[model samples]
Every structure is written in C-alpha cells, then in structure tokens.
Target: MGRLIRPDGLAVGERVRFDGQVRLVLAVTGRSVTLSDIGGTPRAVPPALLFANGDFEVVDSSGRMPLPPVSLLETLPQAALERALWWEGHILEVLNGLPPDAEAGTEPKPQYAPSRSL
Candidate 1:
C-alpha cells in the first residue's frame, strides 16, 4: 500500500477506480494526475482521490504495456514527461518482479461449470 504523500504510486495505464469507474493514467505530474476513460477523454485528477477507496489495482494491468510513448503524450507538459517515463518504468519493474523470463499474464483461467442435462 502506498501513502497519500506519494499518491498511491500509480503508473500510467494501470487500472484504477475513480468514483467507481475505472480510469487510465494519461499523465502524472508532481501536483496532479491525469486520467482518461476508454474514450480517451481526459480530466485533471488529484492524488488524494486516487486511493481514497483503497481500490488501486482493480485489475492487473501487468499483462500489457500501458500508456503511450512520451512522443505521443502531447497532453502532458514538457517538464513532466521525463518523470512520467521514469515512473512508468519503475511501476513495470515492481509489477514484473525479478524474473526476466516470467510471463506477464499467467493467472489460471476459470473453468466453466458443466451444464446439467434437462
């Protein structure tokens, strides 16, 4: 668990719930975090609201690469880009763990219940 002082340490593209709706981190600055919906519409988000529900990581975003390259993140201010990239790599490291060859999404699939004959 992360502290509010660090704003939950969320990385871009990591799954998180805000107001009960899942959102993606488009950008993060020293002061605020930017979130986007599936439609890519962005909104200014405060760090305090990010973890208020203790609902960080509602879904494991580790399977896929999250967020756009810094080049495509035109919405972010120039100064925040480098830091965002650094944070992005750091988050991936933590989520990925120590095994370099480990598969990203290895969670066992759920088995469906067999249907009974009517």
Candidate 2:
C-alpha cells in the first residue's frame, strides 16, 4: 500500500502508481476512473477498488490545471455594468468625499465630506 492521496481530486493525464505499476489517468467520472498502462492498455475500475486503503500515489503532476481567465469586466451585461458602476461611485464617494463623476467645484456629499472625520 502507498501513502494516501486525494483520489477524488485526481485529474486526467496525471500519473499514478498502484499495483506495482505506473498508469496514466485517462478519465475520472462520478462512478469510475479509466487508466492506461505504458503499453496503452486501458482499465476501468471503481475508485474504491483503485484507492482502497490508499493503495495509490501520485507519481507525476504534469497535468496540473490552470484557472480559467476572467480579465474582461467591461463585457458584463447591462444590469451587471450598472451595478458595478453604482458600487464604484459609492466607493469613490466614501474614499474621496465626492462622487467619481462630480464636477471639479461641486461640493462633496454631506455624508462623505472630506472636511469631516476624514
């Protein structure tokens, strides 16, 4: 038996060792996992049998996954854009004592006046 690793967290393409052999993970579903041997022979087994008593260990982690990109905030829907703009204005009012689009000579909001407690 090998040291325990989180089998449920295994990803396709990761290499794991068990039964004195190293296999490449092919797929992981809710019920079973598919693995392939070095000869390209495939085996499907229940996670329970494969990981019984922690009989498996991750040998290679070259399949590490990356988080998806979410750098486009300006593409938000109209409602989300409005809400984001409202929150930005509110935050700017609180931090700068004036709304983000306030005119240069406009007076600060009474509740967020910079002359007050800061």
Candidate 3:
C-alpha cells in the first residue's frame, strides 16, 4: 500500500473512499482523518485504513461555507454571546458523542446527526 495522506492537508467536505465505500472528510489530525458517515456523524480513522489511489473529490461549498462576515460578528449584542456559547457547546457535545471505536467496527449510532447549520 502507498503512504497515507496526512489529514491536515485535507479540507473539510473532501470526499474519499475506503474499503469500497465512500465517505466525506470532515476533519483532520496528524495521525488520522475524520469522516462523515451517511447520517453525517464524524468518525476518526487512522491513516492505515485509507488507500492511496481511489476516487476522491474536494467538496467546496463555494460561498456556502463562507467565513462568518466580520460585520455580523461585530454587530452581535451581548446576549448573542450566549447563542455563540451554545453553538460551541453543541459542537463539543457532538464531538464527545462520537464512539471511541467509531473507525474500528463500532458503527455510529443512528440517533446522531451532524450539525449542518454550523
């Protein structure tokens, strides 16, 4: 097998194939890549599970995944801070909810859903 691609080099939304199935790259780390399953929950996987040559595509949302406009971030009232905190907390909850063996054969729970509005 060829050397695995480092997860840091990948951008969110990139599509990659492994074990004859297709999954989207959701996040990256020095030693592993996180992929979104059919329900959109991210699962971290080691580089060893990734193949070198398979169908891959970068999932660009164009402006859909655009950075939060500075104007919006600046105009928020003090109360909005709570909303931001809530959002961050939700993200952490999702991350924490993932199975430790998500990549090893423990399938993701069907009740989990990826946060698309983030």
Among these predictions, the greatest TM-score belongs to 2
- Give candidate 2's error at residue 84 in angstroms: 42
Better of 1 and 3 by TM-score: 1
- Model 1 misplaced stretches (Cα beyond 4 Å): 1-8, 53-58, 67-118
TM-score of each: 0.43, 0.45, 0.37
Model 3 has an lDDT value of 0.53
lDDT of every model, 2 decimals: 0.59, 0.68, 0.53
lDDT of 3 by residue, 35-113 (tens): 7666445678765556453533343433222123345446588788557655654544455444333455444344554
Report the C-alpha lDDT of model 1 over 41-118, residue by residue, as the tens digit: 688776666655455444545654565645566678877887877676655555554223447765422331123221
Model 2, position 73: C-alpha lDDT score? 37
lDDT, candidate 1, residue 51? 56
Best by lDDT: 2
Q: In model 2, which runs have C-alpha deviations exceeding 4 angstroms?
A: 1-5, 63-118
**Candidate 3: segments with Cα more than 4 A from true spot:** 1-8, 52-118
Ranking by lDDT: 2, 1, 3
